[model samples]
Target: MFKKIDFSFEIKAIGYAFYFSFLPFLFFVFQFLFGEKELSFILLKQMEFLIVPFSAWWIIFLYHDYFEEGGSDLLYSYPLKAEEHGLLRIGVFSALYEILIAICCMFLIVRFPDANFFVLFIQYAAESLLYTSIGFVIILLTKKVMVPILMIVAYVSTEFLTEGSITPVFHIMSFNTEPLSLDQIIFSVLLNGCISVILFVFGHLYLRKKTDLRLF
Candidate 1:
C-alpha cells in the first residue's frame, strides 16, 4: 500500500522522537512555567536552534536502525518498497512537525503581537528541513547516525562562531541581529527547501544503488 507504514516502526519512531524531543520540550515548557510571558530574544534563539534538531536525531535513528543495525536482508523482507518506506518516513514526520511548529508559532504570536508569525513558521520549517536532510544524507553515506549528528553539531557551531560571515543568506541565525524583509525570508526558504529536497533525492538514489549493489 502506498499509504501504509509498518505499525511497529511507527510506534518505535514515535518513541524515539519523544526521547529526542524531551529536553527541548522542557526548555519550551519552562518559558511558561517561569513567567516568560513577554517575548524574549533568548527564547527566540532557543526555539530556532531547538527546532533545527527536533526531528533530525530520530530520522537518523530511523535510517540507521533499518539500514545499519537492522541488517540489509531486512530491507528486502519489508512489506513496503525501500523508496516508499523512506518517503513515508519523511512525509509523515514533516507533516506532524508542521502542526507542532504551528502550535509553537501560535503561542509566541499570542505573547508578542508584533511577531511575524508567517516568517517565524517559514524560518523554522526551512532550517529544520535543511538540517534533517543533512542528517539524512550523511547517515546514508556513513551508515551511522552519530557521525552526522556530530558533523551537524560541528557545522552549526562553526556557523555560530562565524556569525554567518561565510554564508550570510544561509545561516540559521542570519536574521537574529537585524530583521530581514519578507522577500529575503521567502528567498531563504526557497533556497534551503530546494537544497533539502535535493539531498533527500540524493539519499534515495544512494539507497537504491546500495540495494542494487547488494542484489547484484
Candidate 2:
C-alpha cells in the first residue's frame, strides 16, 4: 500500500506546505529577537487559526495537479482502484500536515514550558481533517480546482463574520481560552472526526461512479 505513494511528490508538497505554515512563526521569531515577548502567545494563537485554512488550501491546490490535461488520464489509468488512490492521496497529505502541526506545537512548547499545547494540537488535528474532507468533497463533486478555492474563501468569510459564535458546528475556530475538559475534547474529536469520515465516504462513493475526469 505504501509503495503506491509518490514519495518525491509527497516530500515536495510537505516542504512547500511547511514553508508557508511556518511563516508566522518566523515572523514571531523576528519579533522576539526585537524584544517583543508578548508575541509568543500571539504566535501560538496564530498557529491555531492558521493551521486549518492553510492545510485546507494546500490540499485543494495540490488536487489541481492531478486534473491537468494528460495528467488526469495517466493518473486514472494507474493499476490501483480509484478509491484506493483517493484514500492514499488523502492519507499521505493528511499525515504530512499533522506532522507539520506537531513540529510547530513542539517548538511552541519548548519556548513556553507551562503552556498546554497538547489540547491545541488535538483540536488542530480534528479541524485539519474536517477541512481536508470538505476540500475532498468539493473537488470530487465539481471536479474543478477553482471551486474548492472559492468555497474556502466563502467559508473563511463566513467564519470571520460569525467569529463570536460559541457553537462548534458554526465555527471551526471555536477553541476556548480555558483548558478543555475531557468530555469537551472527546465531543470535538467525535464531531469533527465523524463529519470527516462521512465526507470521505461520500467522496469515495462519488469517485467510484464518476465518469468524467476533465475539470471543465
Best-fitting candidate, scored by TM-score: 1
lDDT of 1 by residue, 1-216 (tens): 435666576657446554665577667757745754544655566666665566576667776556556665766666656576565676666666676777777766766677788887887778888877888888778877679989878777777667667776556544473334577678778888899899999988877777666541
Compare the candidates by lDDT and give the number of the best one: 1
TM-score of each: 0.84, 0.78
- How far in Å is the alpha carbon of 118 misplaced in model 2? 3.5
- Can you write out model 2's per-residue Cα lDDT over 78-185, one digit (the tens) per residue? 676765657777887788878877766676666666656777588778878888889888976776877886877677666555664533455555545443545667
The regions of model 2 sitting more than 4 angstroms off are 9-35, 68-70, 166-169, 175-181, 211-216
Error (Å) of candidate 2 at residue 58 is 3.5
Q: Candidate 1: what lDDT?
A: 0.69
For candidate 2, give the lDDT.
0.66
Q: How close is candidate 2 to the true structure, as a TM-score?
A: 0.78
